[model samples]
Target chain A: MSLIGLISFIGTIIIFLLSKKVYKKMNWIILSPLLICPLIIIAILLITHTSYSDYNSGATWLSKLLGPATVAFAVPIYKNFPLLKKHAKAIGLSLVTGSAVAIISSFLFAMWIGLSNDMVNSLVPRSITTPIAMDISEIIGGEPTMTAVFVIVTGLTGSIIGPLVIKYIRIRTSAAKGLLLGMGAHGCGTSKAFEIGELEGTYSSLAMIVAALISIVLSDTFFPVLQHYLVG
Target chain B: MYMKIIKIILQIIFLYGILLLGDGIARLVHLPIPGSIIGLVLLFTALQLHIVKLEWVDLGAGLLTGELLLFFVPSAVGVVQYDQILGVIGVKLVAVIVLSTIVVMACTGLVADSVQKRGAKKA
Candidate 1:
């Protein structure tokens, strides 16, 4: 039992490494590791008749590293602070407006479509990164697991349509492109930003983090009450 | 080679230490934010304050954060556990996520672009 778990855990790393090469060869978003790696792992487990619980005993190690990796995100943010500092005023204003719009629109849209209040609440934190979004979802009385799903779908949405949006919209600046992707898509969007350029990646990282902080304050302190009044 | 290895190890330790400190403060203050984010903020402050140098963490941060998506797999697989819940509202949820993401991206891009253009004009 333990052996299967360990093998499955290590198998994830090897598969991911292999997927990277596949990604390089295919060069398609549909074939990207984020979508593919998980599918492969799930397939392997299903074939072997290994329970998700058994497979996860080892997989949890990789998951645990996520927190520290998030902490490490500060390094790049720190390195890029100087460039971001110059646009502090712009970043500040845009982030506030963007975050507010994300929360309000998602909440209203979910409600308008006749979903439950809890579903709307889950959608509220969908625009931000997973770790922070999951935390916010709990505070706002949304389902964390559902919130994660929303976050991934959001990222996938951005990854698919992000470039088209940029090209047609004529955003014209790397900064705006970064912010658009980061604020809308979160981590995967940040990945797209890097693909565009260094400056875009930096700006997207800033956008992601700023939007995250704004959501934390609003969701934890105010969103629960807001949800009650709006939905009730 | 040995010195380089030590440097990398020390860098990871420093980052982990920073993360722990952030976690402690967050627990103490009862902040709504995650410890990792607080750690990011603290690390940012440390960088600005010159409490730590950028080079110490450059490699480690790049290596880890570059592959950040892998860490998200476990939580994502939780979707498998939610088959029944998903069946109820999966279609609507997907619609909302797709449409809302497009709108949000456009709105954010428009706001940032207009503000940045104005900033440039002023400068």
Candidate 2:
């Protein structure tokens, strides 16, 4: 790689590590590495007059690792299969409903605000985890990078308001709470679930996996039809 | 220590192999879904069927997922390019995402909670 590429790559890792430290010390969701690390990297690139292509030459290497990491998701899903089976009905029905609502509501909201089809497609996958969400965005003719931004912003929003929703709604069941966070926010929500309890965390993660799978299946089927009618 | 490192590397390679297998299958079948997702399902099924043991991939998988966010940085940072698109409607877009998040949380939590409560009562 070129020296510029190397700088971008190394700079990302260093900033990520430091940002993780800051998040730990502050425990503030706003300071999350997912939110700030990119902000810092983008600022550096702009200030240095470095084009994204130059930075990406090296950073793309890290992004490629996401493919294998996506496969790696199976380990946790497999480990938690028993739990998934145990609460099959509740998880199944709710995730089906939740995933449907996620897509439908995103489309409605995006359309209500007069966003184009592309932005709606991107926003539809905003509720899922990043890698899968990005994949879905590409599949449906949305900009994956824009979807990534929407996904992170969605994560931050959901995690921030998730606790307040739980409190005001008087949700007492850990399973319900976990499903709410995971289905609503994905990874950040799962982390928030952990802070509440282990069971909440476990269920939250399970919700993310199942919700993602369901959303994928929906993307191939329901999503296109929705787009045809709504955006067409 | 050396063995541990070797094991991790080998497991990662194994995972990569599975990812490639997924890509091959997706191409062959012309599936609409992404191959990594196909690989995820395949791996999960293999574990369930005892065709692939969990220990073989556990450490490497853990390592990858643990740093998953790092993998997303390049793509997310690419958002900088879309500044012009986001500049005008950014505020409205953020509001939509926030409002939708609240709606999603409410619907999911309420539905799940009621279903769970009914299940508990029936038991």
Candidate 3:
């Protein structure tokens, strides 16, 4: 690899690790490693006038790891199977409903604001985890990079507001609390769920995985029909 | 310690093999879904059937999933390429996501809670 590649590669890891420590110490939403690390990297690339391709030359390998990570999702989903089995009724209904609501509402809002068809497609899967969302984006002809941004923003916003919504609504059950965070924000929501309680965290992670599956099915079967009606 | 490291490496390789198989199936069949997702389903099914033990893949899968954020950081930063889109409608786009997130959170929580309450009442 070129010196630039090595620098970008090592720099990304160092920044990410440092930001993780800062986030741990600060425990602030704005300081989240996901949001902060990327922001800092982007700023550095911009200020130094380095092109994205140069940075990505080394970073693409890291990005490709997402494929294996996607398969790895099965582990958590499998481990959490018992939780799904326990709250089978509540989880099944709520997540299906939540996933539907997430996709439909995102489409409607995007259309109402007059986003392009491709942009609408990207927004539809923004509520799911990044890997699956990007995959769904590509399958549906959306821009995967744009979809990633939307997913991250959704996660950040969802985690920030998820707890407040739970508190205000007086959502009592750990199952409901978990599903809300997981379905609403994906990974970030699951972490926040952990802060609230252990059971909430388990349920949240289960909800996140199940919600991704639900959204995938919905995107394949339901979203196209909705798009035809609204955009056509 | 060396044995543990080797075990994880081997398990990861096994998982990667499933991923390859899934990609092959998707290409052969021309499935609309992505291969990784298909791999996820395939792995989940294997684990459920006890064909692939959870203990076998658990540690390796856990490591990959735990670092999921790092894997995507490059792609997320690729957004810098879309400065034109972000310049024009970034605020509106953020608005849409924030609004939709709030709606989904409230709706999911309320619906799930109410359903659980009804079930509790009946029982």
Candidate 4:
């Protein structure tokens, strides 16, 4: 990477760190680093006429670190294992059915709209966290970049409308409400759950991780059958 | 301070080693899931069996998780490449996402709520 690219990468991280502070301080979802950092980086790239390739040169280093970071998720999953075991049946059943509903509906809708195969696969995993969604998208021949956009949009939308929907549904427990948010909105929703209560945050975090695992398993099995059905 | 730095670096190497082992096994076995995920499972196992202590790698993993979102920023910023492609399917993508999200959220909440409530009654 060139000197400018290195500077750009460091500068982007610094700016994103600042935006995250603002996000936490203001408590506005709009200021989410997930939303703002990308916008800021893209804007800088555009204004400076730094091509995507040049920017990617330095950015790829950060991306490479994503692998270890994803692996690190095991720590939290392990920490929560006891809670996970306690509610195993409910969480398991909820994840399977929720992911099924998401996959089948989104696939049918995508097919109905005549979306290409890649878009269908990508859209199918939009509800998962960004890293896992991106991985799933790539494995299924979808665009990771598009997957991120889809994830962000889906998560942001769910976070925005989730409370109203939950209120109308009258879910009696914070755990239940958190499950809804986590499965539907992922990282974005889990953060929102943190605002609601401790139990909500715990369930949301658990749901988020469990839902990702369930989605991966589902896609592994469902993708082959769906592929044959959709394109055959 | 010096020992702390070394410990952090060693833990990072441990995590990275697991990732590579996962990649190797995935290739040999033709696993559909990604290598890092497999590494995650292996690491968890190691911790459970006392093959690897949590303290050894927890700090290293914390370093990764702390700025985990930052790692994704570069790739997410790759959205610029999809400007034209998005213009084509943007509306449909948005619609599908919106509809599915609502349905998933409602159902998951209802299911978890009712299931737990029933379990409580039974116990």
What is each model's TM-score for chain A? 0.88, 0.79, 0.82, 0.76
Worst 10 residues of 1 chain B by lDDT: B76-85
**What's candidate 3's DockQ score?**
0.61
Q: How far is A207's C-alpha from truth in model 1 (Å)?
A: 1.6
| C-alpha positional error of residue B25 in candidate 3 after TM-score superposition, expressed in Å | 2.2
The stretch of ten residues in a row with the least summed lDDT in candidate 3 chain B is: B63-72
User: Model 1: per-residue lDDT, tens digit, A98-193?
Assistant: 788888889877887899877788888999988889998888788987888888778867777888888888999888998888888887788778
TM-score-based ranking: 1, 2, 3, 4
Candidate DockQ scores, in order: 0.68, 0.62, 0.61, 0.57
Per-model TM-score on C-alpha atoms: 0.91, 0.86, 0.86, 0.83
What would the per-residue lDDT of candidate 4 be over residues B1-123, giving only the tens digit for each residue? Answer: 999888887887888888899889888998766777788889888888889888988888877766666776776677678764477577777888888888888888889889999999999
Which window of ten consecutive residues has the lowest lDDT sum in model 4 chain A? Answer: A194-203
- Supply the global lDDT for candidate 3: 0.83
lDDT of each: 0.81, 0.84, 0.83, 0.79
Residues A1-232, model 2: lDDT tens digits:
9988898888899998898899889988677677788999989888988899999999998888878877887886677778767788888888898999999998899899998878788888999988788889998889887888888778767877899899999998888999999999986787678668767876787788788989989998999999888767
- Clashing residue pairs found in predicted model 3: none
- TM-score of the candidate numbered 4? 0.83
Docking class of 2: medium
On residues A1-232, what C-alpha lDDT tens digit does candidate 4 reach at each position? 7897798678878987898888889987556777788888889888999888888888788778767765776776677778767887888778778888888888888898888887788788899877778888887778887788788778767877678778988888777888888888876677667567656755776677778888888877887688788789
Displacement of residue A3 (Cα, Å) in model 1 is: 2.4
Error of 3 at A79 (Å): 2.6
Q: What is the TM-score (0 to 1) of chain A in model 4?
A: 0.76
Report the C-alpha displacement of residue B35, candidate 3, in angstroms.
2.0
Tell me how far the alpha carbon of residue B103 in candidate 2 is from the true structure, in angstroms, after superposition.
Answer: 1.6
